[model samples]
Target: MIALSRKHRTALAMIGFLCLMTGSGCDYRKEFQFSGPTMGTTYHITIKAPFWNSMTSLDRSIREELAAVNKSMSVYDKESEISRFNAIEDTRQSMEISERFAEVLSLSKQVWDLTEGAFDPTVFPLVRIWGFYTGNENGLPDEKTLEAIHHQVGFGYVRFDDRNHIGKCIPEISLDLGAIAKGYGVDQIAAVIRKAGYTDFLVEIGGEVVASGRKASDQPWRIGINYPDPAAPLDLVYKSLTLQNKAIATSGDYRNFRQIGGKRYAHIIDPRTGSPIDNGVVSVSVIADTCALADGLATGLMVMGHEKGIALVEGLPGTECLYLVKNAEGALQEFASSGFGKTP
Candidate 1:
């Protein structure tokens, strides 16, 4: 597996990719396994039967799409499309972008509006200043530094046109897709798999998981919600959830963290405050109808904490979250909403 640290912080991943052989009821079978990088983490997807033969196509094309996404969205990358937009009079403001851009921008706006600017993409300056980005790590910025970037933050400062497929920023502001792009990638691959005429498979791009249909054994999709701990072994998973025709995404402050000057800092940043939200929560797992919704909710709930986050999920038309909070004794606690009761 290709291991990459998160702004939130991270560890090695031991993922399994399994494909069933075809015989009688299924005449052919194949299995290909590899660790694919995503969401600043490494993930493995096992395509079975017909797809095993086309593993190269899936790997090459998926990596390219992810690269394109990073180029267009990662604020840490200077030459990326989003970075370039914040560079200056980005003249290509009205030009057509890839389909992924359109979908992501729309989702970004929705979450930003819904959260009342809590989920802004333009908070990169603040994020970077607080050491959540590439430059700093577990180092708190002075008030002056925080103030300097605060003005450059806020989703309201960014502008885009969906009909014309264009985007623009205040030049000083940047976009970070750390919260949403992986789900979009999963959605893209799901669309691709559907196009490929595969009916039974599971696609998880960096924990933004989407399970299309049942396995050949008529079993529901099984997903594990990890127990977060930076000081312990990563492969030691403490929980697992099963789903069929569902999306499971987890946002936590566990893996991605830094300790400097005896202070522990997680990578999950609060856009409004330019710091991490120390909700007693370890991780937030959400199950929803759409991967995009689950991804956004996971991020939002991670910041909103347990009480408000659970309230938000309860009020939503169809959304569910399991809040894994850490107690004073360094133990994990669980909280779920009525919406979670509907999840299977």
Candidate 2:
């Protein structure tokens, strides 16, 4: 489901996230650039190096590989394998799904189970009902209407068999991959890049960013975290860290929701309630070994809110999160996992 960001009267903003050039102390710099189309969105890559020039051919390979990934995963595309399966579930005795597709759904189930229905694919029905997937160009839904959608949302309904690459949809149920598919696709593309002997690189899909290696400039890449305020320049550097074999993802409901009836509602919905989240969190950023984990987990955190989400992140090794939310005083409060604050 696509998120619908709510605009509030309060002047608080935490906006966009960017993957930047890698290096150290603003001096070291590397020249690595790779950008190609996939997933109905262009993927941009920047790598620093002699390695960059050495692997120029890799740019084309990376793009081509990611395109293949999109074919199997995109629920939005009617011709996509997943989309076709969604359309034809009852017509055939069995539904054919791809190995990669099965893997993503399988991983999604894990998050669904771990979070106890927080990150659910079955919430697609609720998403469609609210018109986030279609009709209503405007954002936010009436509370009574959204709460009714809660009946159709559940993660346990999506059934798949990885061994045979088959998936079946329960009646009246739809699947939404807006939260995790992009990251999973990025991970697949990254795997292809590393397999082809490219080491130092960065990859971004619709603002989900991951990078590795140092820039020729010798400084860690500086990522600019946007403040939602339109008037404010993106001067605040939220992080200066090397991707250096790590993946990072940031998820926020602020970017996509709309204001309604003087209340602020997040595009991120609570599957159990089938309503837009009221979790005061502005954004949740995650760091992990793979973009897939970081991506799915970020969505999970969005659906989980602050306290429960932080508890979840704290218990997972190598998983750190920074949550931005409105405090009791209405001033912004930043809560970071132990692994996050040390970034230069």
Candidate 3:
């Protein structure tokens, strides 16, 4: 339920357009950029290809890929596959879903289990009750109200099978893929670019990014993690990584929060406690082989806090995390996995 300011959206939309229109070309390769709005945010893509490669066809294919993802996953779309399923009221009946929908759901389940319910798409009810969802009143709910809603929140209520049929055990249970869909969109577009025989490209949706091969300058792609300081400039970099053939997704509480009763509540809710996360951990960034995994894990890690988060990541091969936490004295501190800043 995090809201993006109009200013942030406009800045993202302009970045790729300016890069593409200016014809920023090097001696051996030309970098082509494409950008537009999607999934409640903007996406920017840059491809380093030979001078002869046609951006026209690639642009068409990339847009098609994004459209397909939005059609399947966007909750805002009343006619989307997810919305249609959410409309169903019968627990005994199951609806057949597209393969792409099943793919994202399967990944969601894995992250849900791995994080021990730290991340649950079924937490939509709690999100609504906390007034994080649009059109809801923002206030602390009574204990009775919180208890009633907790009964409706759990991934166990979601029923699905290998045949791509999905149903909820209760009519009130619903799914929201906001935490992971953008990363999945990035992965899908990266696949599209690879299918077009392009080896060097970077795909970014919102702040989730995936890098493939080196840039036209023969250097690894440099990605900056946003500094989780509300007072600082929006594009300020806390850390930079040179990435190749990897994905990074960051989730932070600094930007998305509601001030109520003279205290701030983060948009991220703990499905287990049926409450907004108030832990001092302010930001989490995950690096993984796939952006979808990174995206889900980032949110889950934020809920897990620092100690357990670091321990959980240490066991996950090819997965690393960086956590920015606030000490009791109100100072920013950093905790990272063993291989967090290492070049992959």
Candidate 1 residue runs with Cα over 4 Å from true position = 1-35, 38-40, 48-71, 74-79, 89-96, 135-139, 165-169, 260-263, 341-344
How badly does each model clash, as a count of residue pairs? 7, 20, 0
Q: Candidate 1's residue-wise lDDT over 301-330, tens digit each?
A: 888888888887787766788998888887
lDDT of each: 0.69, 0.69, 0.91
List the candidates' TM-scores in order.
0.81, 0.81, 0.91
Instruction: After superposing candidate 2 on the true structure, give the runs of residues whose Cα lies further than 4 Å from its correct spot.
Output: 1-30, 51-56, 89-92, 133-148, 228-242
| Candidate 3 residue-wise lDDT, 1-344, digit = tens | 22347875576556657777887642546788999999999999999975545588879999998999999999999999999988989999899999999999999999999999999988988887888767665578889999999999999899999999999899988899999999999999999999888889999999999999988888899999998978879999999988899999999989877888898888899999999898899999999999999999999999999899999999999999999999889899999999998975
Model 1, residue pairs in steric clash: 8-256, 8-267, 9-255, 9-256, 9-257, 22-26, 23-26
Candidate with the greatest TM-score versus the true structure: 3
Residue 135 error for model 1, in Å? 5.1
Residue range with the least summed lDDT across 10 consecutive positions in model 3: 1-10
How much is 142 displaced in model 3, in angstroms? 1.2
Best by the lDDT measure: 3
Q: How many collisions between residues are there in candidate 3?
A: 0
Worst 10 residues of 1 by lDDT: 10-19
